[model samples]
Target: MADFTGASTGGVSTIVTDHAALISACAAGEKQALKTLMKAEGGRMLGVARRMLRRSDLAEDAVQDALVLVWRRAHQFDASRGSAKGWLYTILRNRCLTMLRQEDREVATEADQIEATSQEAVLTAAFDGLETTTGLRQCLERLDGATRQAILSSYVLGHSHGEIAGRLDAPLGTIKARVRRGLLKLRECLS
Candidate 1:
């Protein structure tokens, strides 16, 4: 229950206290100890969650879930093995990763599929509608096939340079260079 100020938190002085004792109090169903723990570490916890989750809303959700878990599992915390702060962050990180995994596993609905297909069709039509004899199309055709494909994948197909590199089985740097050099050549040809 002793409190002192310290600079351990990235130059920000926060009241230093025994997190283990706070957790113990929480384990004993002391609500005030939990509030004190949150007051001391909530911002840091949120920051950790935000970095892991990326999206603010998702980070908030993860932190909220972590805090709830901490409340429920306080009795299980073993201070001899690790610090309470480390325990808190582990929970937050696990929650964030779980959310990310769940998002990856989500099945796209029929509406989502149709929307994606329509968007892809629009981009494809725009690229295909370019007349073969037109100056732009001629310039694109003049480039090496790999370079032209790289530029088209990035600009018209809306793929990232990394994605284009993966698709072409080329290095990321090579894909980026192709797109840059192709654009420069096209500008010179157009001008």
Candidate 2:
């Protein structure tokens, strides 16, 4: 079936030197340099924050704040210790670390190895904590059988639409429709 979302990711390339020129230009008070730097490194910084905070908007905000700080402090930059790219990375890292520390104060408990060691167990415990009937399972139960199965396969089993279709012996379009309908039904039920 067609994936109209146009979502595809791959071919990771790690470059430590991409931001050096932009940093140098920014340090020289070139506004164009700062703009170039933002365009060049924004995606990477966003990825870093997202991985650290597990939240998209917060990650974007963190990167934006870091870029602002970098622009304001560019004059004090020292090239002897590290490259400009490294300096930008340090700024983003510090911002994410600080945000994480502040967020830690509000959370009741930390979730360190819980995701790595016993993810299913953690999810089960969290789900069971819902004293109300609006838990994930109950909401899922309200969906059509095929749709619920498709959604469960994609979300819980971590399968793609094609994989779910293959496993369930259904057409890919059918699987995608089921998954979408299932998710909408679940959201409505929970709401």
Candidate 3:
């Protein structure tokens, strides 16, 4: 066995040396080589997946899928364009992104159903139960017209700062500043 550990200095680099040989061994149906590759790279791959998915179970799933892919498609890995480590990570990243896109679609479909409840309806229900509405109204009244409008567009109408800027014919920075200042004033008044 060639010294799999190369002279590179980093943690990943230490394990990633001679990836081509490991991948070739996998391609040649060497199960121990595949196991060696997994032993070396699994933790880092899981970390990458966890960062991307933000959930342990999802990260594990992605890493498992990526390993299965590495097993089946080991013969397809081309060493000319990039390192074998890069190829492995590309597969893992793609799997994570695909899972995320699927999750986003599921959430979007669910959100479509929930969107029938207007923000105003929700706010009205909340304010109806709270005695702080009077204080909030008074604080809002103290704001300058532009700042108040910015806050209202953001909090009441659910507009993004960019959208508020477009609607108010102001720069994005100005809109952000107005909203920040307005919130600070409201906070001071409420406290």
Candidate 4:
């Protein structure tokens, strides 16, 4: 999806694969292999970016940028770290996180938004009237499964820290950390 015509003679080839033989062909300077890899994985990349950005247009652009990185830095794909899938996901996810952080930095939050919710009891009450909470739920799914559940119990369900700890049967400190970190992340995302 990214145009590399300005790069060089490397722009002229058509290697098509339903997967990434990119780690192989890329080292050989086969730009077409990169194209093959992108065509195969770009849709999924867009989907991930879409989930993060929640905008089709931004998702498309993010995928375009991600693909450009994939193409240009194809050599960085290391099989030992994992498959092409993991590597690609890491890059796109990082881009999405960076974008989220940038959005936070670039757009000033209203005084109300900047006001941190004071009590655990108020979280559910605050969100109860919000239709956008479903979107918030979806965004929370981006966390690891345990972290996601811990967060839902605390915020969306308004469980007290002790209650969440009891329900999860996790250490109190662990649950607290997860809740603190998860809320911070959700605030970043929902912002």
Q: What is the C-alpha lDDT of each candidate?
A: 0.71, 0.65, 0.73, 0.62
List candidate 2 stretches off by more than 4 Å.
1-18, 104-191
After superposing candidate 1 on the true structure, give the runs of residues whose Cα lies further than 4 Å from its correct spot: 1-14, 104-191
Q: Per-residue lDDT for 74-141 in model 4, tens only?
A: 77777776777777777777776666546543341331143333323344444454465586865676
lDDT of 2 at 63: 94
- Weakest ten-residue segment in model 1 by summed lDDT: 105-114
Clashes of each: 0, 0, 0, 0
As a whole number from 0 to 100, the lDDT of residue 105 in candidate 4 is 31
lDDT of 1 by residue, 20-56 (tens): 8888888999988777777777777776565434457
Which residue pairs does candidate 1 place in steric collision? none
Pairs of residues at least 3 apart in sequence or in different chains that clash in candidate 3:
none
Candidate 2 lDDT trough over 10 residues, lowest sum: 1-10
Comparing candidate 3 with candidate 4, which one achieves the higher lDDT?
Answer: 3
Report the lDDT tens digits of candidate 2 across residue range 1-191.
Answer: 11122223576443433456566667777887676677667786787676555567778989989988898888778878788778888888788767765765334134333233453443344445546565676886567666765665443333468756875798999778778777787788778
The numbered model that scores best in lDDT is: 3
TM-scores, one per candidate: 0.49, 0.47, 0.49, 0.49
Q: Which stretches in model 3 have alpha-carbon errors above 4 Å?
A: 1-16, 104-191
